[model samples]
Target: MKYLETYRLTNLPAKAYYIPDFISDAEEHFLLQKITNAPLSKWTVLSNRRLQAWPTQLLKGSVLPTTDALPTWLDDPLVQRMVSLDIWRQSPHDRANHCLINEYEPGQGIMPHEDGDVYHPVVATVSLQDGIVLDIYRKTEDGKREIVYRIYQEPKSLLITTEDMYTDYLHGIQDIDVDKSLYRDTVANWDFLSDDTKQRIELSGGDLKRKRARVSLTFRDVKKVRNLAAFLQMK
Candidate 1:
């Protein structure tokens, strides 16, 4: 696939790719099953969303103790496709070593924040189940922030953020049951969405109602790692 031509979000920042239908419905179903079937303890409950970190969460944001790879269910075709795209080729490890699975029920969204410095400055997010609008903000010199753009992420779509988009902007989803003002002018990737999605938004008179749960699989390469012995010794 000519990725540049097929999935480009040109108006936003230096780099952000929105690939609709990146995964098949069957694949999405399988992934949801795997996520839901995982042992309950694997999920770390946050105030707004619950998450499961693969290969374990970083130790102090700078160390990974396990050499074990991501589970086959998570890695197989998806990771392989991501690797083929070569988005992470320049990253330290040349591939993502971690996956953060976050589940957000309707009306639950994360606060506006950057991904921070724990990982390579690139993120590949796969949305499942439902779609939501991710608001991007710019911090002003006076310390206030303003919503500069919004991207609607659809189910089974791949949203890749890199370079300026990943490093310079704060991205988050609003905790609203309905997303208003959705139209060609308000949505950054409006031109790239599927016709059906666009029609639904238009039919609602530019307001998109939110329903169903949404899950995001965020893949990144953590910059730190340590063997188990070294990790234990530090403790």
Candidate 2:
């Protein structure tokens, strides 16, 4: 994470970085186009959101089926830039092998949850189209969850979470149409956000409304990969 020290969120638990405008507008447009052109079957429509898993989904919830690599549209620029940061140097694969594309509508969000053990602890997410507030929580000894931190993710921004931030905390987006109280104290990465975004929130009286859909591309290294072709041949 040394390459990302400049963008590190010091207010957070331990190792989380937020980079504003991580991708150029052209690159963001290209990614959105590719996602839109994907086959309808590629999208898994859930109750709250829709998802697309690149190189196909995992096998039995843990092992990545090595039938194909990440497509060019999904690999270049984004993952290549992450490689330059050397964030995955210590991971098992030394690079991300899978990506989860999630599209969330206004007032739609997932529950607080840990990513589990299927992938490495390092997770990098790029937000597109809109901004949202991600609430972080910790579980007490009594098994109750409490919010500890909040992260405001802007469109075209890159957010990397690892170490204690990844292992010791649970994260989720609240199911709401507007994010309120967005200020220096509430958002962990407040200092890193663009001035325009800050002004927008301030002028709105600390409330930022969600007016459009937001798409997130989450990249991670799957720890296990099994040969799908070999398994099919055996059967």
Candidate 3:
């Protein structure tokens, strides 16, 4: 984790990094286009959001299909850039083997939850289109959840969660169009954010109003994979 110390989010957990403008504006548009123009069959529609799994969705047993590697649209410079950070040095694959693209509409969000052990603990997330606030909590001995920190993710940015940030805490976004109670004190990565980004939030009177849709590209390495041909032959 020392390799990534420069981009670390020290205000929150032991290991998490937020890189603003991680991708150029052009790359952001490229990914957003790929998501929006993808075939309807590719999307897995859920109650609050929709998702697309590259290669294929994981089986019920948390097994990934070995039919094909992730498409170029899902890999390329993003994965290469992450590899340089040395976050996945201990993963089974040593690189991301799966990707889940999630599209969230205004006022839609998932509940606080852990990523679980089916995959490696490291998560490299890239945000596109709009911004949002992620709230993190730690479970106490009394079984109560305490809000420990908050992260404001902006478009074209990268958020990497590993170590304590990935294993010991739960993270989620609020299901509201407006995110209030903002400032450098509230957001864990405030000091790392660009000055213009901070001003935009401050000028809005500490209220971040969601005005557009957002899509997240979450990359992780699954621990188990079975070749599709071999799996079908067993049946």
- Regions of candidate 1 where Cα sits further than 4 Å from its true position: none
Question: Which lDDT tens digits does candidate 2 get at residues 1-235?
Answer: 3368899888887899998999989999999999989999999999999999998888777878877789988789889899899899999989999999999999999899999889899999999999999899999889999999999999999999999988999999988999989888888988988999999999998999999999999999999887888766756
RMSD of 2: 1.7
Score each candidate by Cα lDDT.
0.89, 0.91, 0.87
Which regions in candidate 3 have their CA more than 4 angstroms from the true location? 1-3, 229-235
Clashes of each: 0, 0, 0
Q: Give one digit per residue, the lDDT tens place, for model 1 in 1-235.
A: 5664468788988899998888999999999999999999999999888999996777776677767678888888788889899888898888888999999898889999999888899899999999999999999999988999999999999999999998899998888889899989899999989999999999999888888989999999887767778778879
Residue pairs with backbone atoms closer than 3 Å in model 2 (clashes):
none
Give the alpha carbon lDDT tens digit for every residue of 1-235 in model 3: 2357788887776789998888999999898888889999999999988899987888765888877688888778788888988878999999998999988888988888999999899999999999988899899999888888999899998999998888999988778898888888888888877888799899998898988888899999999888877776777
- TM-score between candidate 2 and the true structure: 0.96
Q: What does the lDDT come to for candidate 1?
A: 0.89
lDDT of 2 at 32: 91
lDDT of residue 114 for candidate 1? 96
**1 or 3, greater by lDDT:** 1
- Measured with C-alpha atoms, the lDDT of residue 20 in candidate 1 is 88
C-alpha TM-scores of all predictions: 0.96, 0.96, 0.94
